[model samples]
Target: MKVFSICHVSIVMLSIIIISTNLMIPFYTVVAAETNCSNGDIVIAQSRVGTLPSGIPSFSVEITNACARGCSISNLHLKCGMFASAVLVNPKIFKRQDVDDCLVNGGSPLAAGSTISFKYANSFQYPLSLASATCG
Candidate 1:
């Protein structure tokens, strides 16, 4: 009797597992595709020079949503000269704590195919006109 009962229980459990696995396949596929946004990458990278007497220039760069679907843009870094600066090289420099803040406020969370712009002050102290400006 004990052996029969154990076997019966095992069969029931196996059926449940099989049913669940089958039901999950379709759901999993949809979820996976939804998570995969179209060509996740920032599209635009435009820079504008700030007008200043001290030869200080400011720049703004944007990242689109396509490149940031499931990405987080935090601790944004600003590289004006040939060498990258460690101090400004942070992902959390945005003024607000959202995706758009990375550009207007100082935060970075440009969503997939979404446009996120960032601004940096280019002064003699920072040296924006050095040669290159990179953001990481």
Candidate 2:
């Protein structure tokens, strides 16, 4: 038998490894794609309404992190409306916190299984029959 030098043996082994890795890359990518990546996403829903600290009508939206990783919140367009016997109420988000939050922290993130909420406020008195508000 002939003995190959260490340098030559090293180069041969490295070439084989590189070729194997290249061949396996596509298979690895396909396997990764088959996994359920979308299962780890976020969910938003209309939660409830309550009173603001300054005695105003306020409502909220619940955001839950259903993702396996952190989820970012940004450009959250929130609109308000009421349906009380043909009455129109243009509610506004008391966004001192929200507006400043976007500027300060772009795309606020929530960890997996965590929940955060956005609140909207208006000065609608009780028995006025304001029906529903929407946030997205």
Candidate 3:
């Protein structure tokens, strides 16, 4: 009788452990599925590279998608007020939309861990801030 009781208690404990683990699996899966990218994940790095023949300082801008979960971001817009460059920027890579807005990557999705770079000639670097993005 004593051996039977011991075995019964061990079986009950094992069953509880298994049930709890199973119950927690869905919770973890839900959290993983909800992981998403945001505007903050779009990193923009600009630096002075050199000078142009027109006596203007040249700058290099690198935009990167730093999504931790391999998410993609699209339709990236930046707050670029009166942004202009003596050096021509590829319209497919970056372009001004309005007085205070600019589009990046031609409104296409930038994959996770990917970067787009462009050069511009201006007196000072534009204070570009992420305006918006669509994450997927």
- Give the top-scoring candidate (TM-score): 3
TM-score of 3: 0.74
lDDT of 3 by residue, 13-71 (tens): 12223564564322211222333665568899999999988889999999999988777
Please list the C-alpha lDDT of all candidates, in the order they appear. Answer: 0.35, 0.34, 0.78
lDDT per residue (tens digit) for residues 85-135 in model 1:
212533443332332222222533444345555565544333221111112
Cα displacement (angstroms), candidate 3, residue 67, comes to 0.2
Q: How many backbone clashes does candidate 1 have?
A: 30
lDDT at 115 for candidate 2?
64
Two-way lDDT contest, 1 vs 2, winner: 1
Clashes of each: 30, 0, 0
Task: Encode model 2's per-residue lDDT on 50-119: one tens digit a residue.
Answer: 7656666665556565645333333333222331211222232212223212111123434456665555
Q: Model 3, poorest ten-residue lDDT window? A: 1-10
Candidate closer to the true structure by TM-score (higher is better), 2 or 3: 3
- For residue 83, model 2's alpha carbon misses the true position, in angstroms, by 18
Structure candidate 3, residue pairs in collision: none
**Stretches of candidate 1 above 4 Å error?**
1-33, 37-40, 67-109, 123-136
